[model samples]
Target chain A: MSSPEVLVHLHQKAVLLLQDDANKIEKLIEVQMENLATRKCPLYEEVLDTQMYGFSREVDFAVRAGLIEESAGKAIISKLERNLAQLYEALDQKSQLL
Target chain B: MSSPEVLVHLHQKAVLLLQDDANKIEKLIEVQMENLATRKCPLYEEVLDTQMYGFSREVDFAVRAGLIEESAGKAIISKLERNLAQLYEALDQKSQLL
Candidate 1:
């Protein structure tokens, strides 16, 4: 038995979008983290404030649209937050060392 | 020797947003990937189309607003596309095998 094809496709696409964004963010974090570690200036903040919230809002939209479960979206956000906190802490420490 | 605080802040935020989304997407891909690998049902789609496009739209807004450079936004999208392509291919392969 297959799930509704449209819904299934939506589910697939939803995760794909999130996963794609996540990968993009990971690389940015890596580059910025390197910048922080090396005492180079960090970049991407000006855009990030708007961009990150925008993406999260999209996820929220998905939940609202019933394309995906709220729980899953929340889980993704929780994980993302945890990762960001760690990255922030690492950058903070590195910056302090300089 | 710091840049103008406002621009600097914006730049920092921009990258943070992209990076955070990237992190969130990475986990979604990972979970879905595992699902595919195990020949289990895969999930997350309808929502992603809107969410991903929404986030990208925001990135476009950032560029238009002059919060971040166009090149950086393009670069993020390009990288994200590459990752998504890779995941899609992998899933396709696994599904065919099953």
Candidate 2:
């Protein structure tokens, strides 16, 4: 296959995976937030570590192929990281209350 | 602040952070992939390690809140993990080529 085709193929796969993953992550954050509010586990979810890293790989490939903007890709993952931090903060607050 | 309001606030903040973070991560992955494809780095991006773990925390919180279904949350993370695995496969393929 040509380089362009390869790029498109990779980009398409990454985007598909990304869309599904993003939705799930968004929902996961929502649930985790509720848990903190109700005073559940004080600890943060530990699964995201692998997911984020995996995502980074896809982003790297996509940018190289020109399928996605570098800044745009970074922002997508950063949002998840930032919100994750926020969740950590809320969890900390909830723990203090206990 | 009331519980619901606090939840809303946390959710909003998390969402904003998440959006930004996601973009960054996606870009990071793209770059890393290029590095690998070019033989610049035989190893995968180490930066992703921290990000994935951090994301896990958010997922944990969202799951607790009922904002995300459990299977859904797992799937989100799993997709990244799978792609990461795919990258690893590519790396392995390249190594074999060498």
Candidate 3:
């Protein structure tokens, strides 16, 4: 492959990998949302926060390494953050009802 | 640059980037150790753990992205883990002496 081709391939692979990670976090939020009635474990929030932090680090690394564009990385993270915020909102409402 | 050269350059760049991250964590541990005489903030451990978790994720992503070898990634993390463990041990010893 030529130089541009190599970069293109790496960029695509980087984006795919990041998307896959974002999906995993999405699944986590979904699972927690589904199980909201199962004795709200305090640890779940910590787990999600840690996962998000690690993911942000991964995204930052990809951007710094020039594997993915900065805007693309931020977009992926923003989507997940929105989902996370929704999850937190639901959790808050649940706690208030209790 | 040829295909092999491109790969080589990326691999080197990846290593350097990871090493730089590792050094930042190392510095965190060093500062905590040096400040052992002062009142130990419980939050430091949490911060270090979170940083380690994030760094490990970055290393994992680099390996998955083909920027670095699995063994190389593991080695970088292992070194940091050892340093972290030592810091914890020293903290424990200091607390016991108090």
Candidate 4:
């Protein structure tokens, strides 16, 4: 591969890896949201928080390493944050209903 | 730059960035070890743990992204873990003295 090709491939790979990590966290949020009323794992939130933190670190490193654009990294993280917010909102509504 | 040159440059840059992060954590450990008796920040350990987690995440991402060899990533993390263990041991001994 040429220089530009190599860089592009690396960038795509970095973004793909980050997206995979984000999807795992998204899955976690979905599971917790689905089981919000059934399985009361108190550590679910903690686990999610830790996962998000670790994933964010990965994103941050990618940005710094020039593997992906800063804007791309920010977009991925923002999307996850929005989903997480929605989950928390749903949890709040459920608590209010109870 | 040529393809090989580009790869070499990226690999070196990734290692440098990770080393910089590891050094920051080392500095944190050093500061805490120095203040092991006086400052008594109950949250120091928590902060260090969080930093270590974040740093490790960066290393893991770099390895997955193909920016660094897995062994290089492991070495960086292992060195930090050793220093961290020493700090904890010293903290333990100090408490024992108390």
- Using TM-score as the measure, the top candidate is 4
Q: Write the per-residue lDDT of candidate 2 for residues A31-97, one digit (tens) a residue.
A: 8887765646523365554555555655554454344578877888888888778877887787888
Most accurate candidate by lDDT: 3
- Tens digit of per-residue lDDT, candidate 4, span A18-80: 999999999999998888887456588889899999999999999889888888999999999
TM-score of each: 0.46, 0.42, 0.93, 0.96
**Cand. 4 Cα-lDDT:** 0.92
Off by over 4 Å in 4: none
Categorize the docking of model 3.
medium
**Candidate 4 residue lDDT tens string, B1-98:** 99999999999999999999999999999999999878467699999999999999999999999999999999999999999999999988888888
lDDT tens readout by residue for model 1, B1-98: 23355446545666677667766766666666677646544346434444456667656645644556899989877776677677788877876887
Candidate 1 regions off by >4 Å? A1-3, A40-42, B1-98
Runs with alpha carbons beyond 4 Å of true place in candidate 3: none
Error of 3 at A17 (Å): 1.0
TM-score of predicted structure 1: 0.46
Least lDDT summed over 10 consecutive residues: which range in candidate 3 chain A? Answer: A2-11
Model 3 per-residue lDDT tens digits across residues A3-98: 878888988999999999999999999999999887898898989998999999999999999898899889999999999999999999999999
Q: How far does residue B21 in candidate 2 sit from its true spot (Å)?
A: 23
Work out candidate 3's RMSD over C-alphas. Answer: 1.4
True contacts kept of each: 0.07, 0.00, 0.79, 0.86
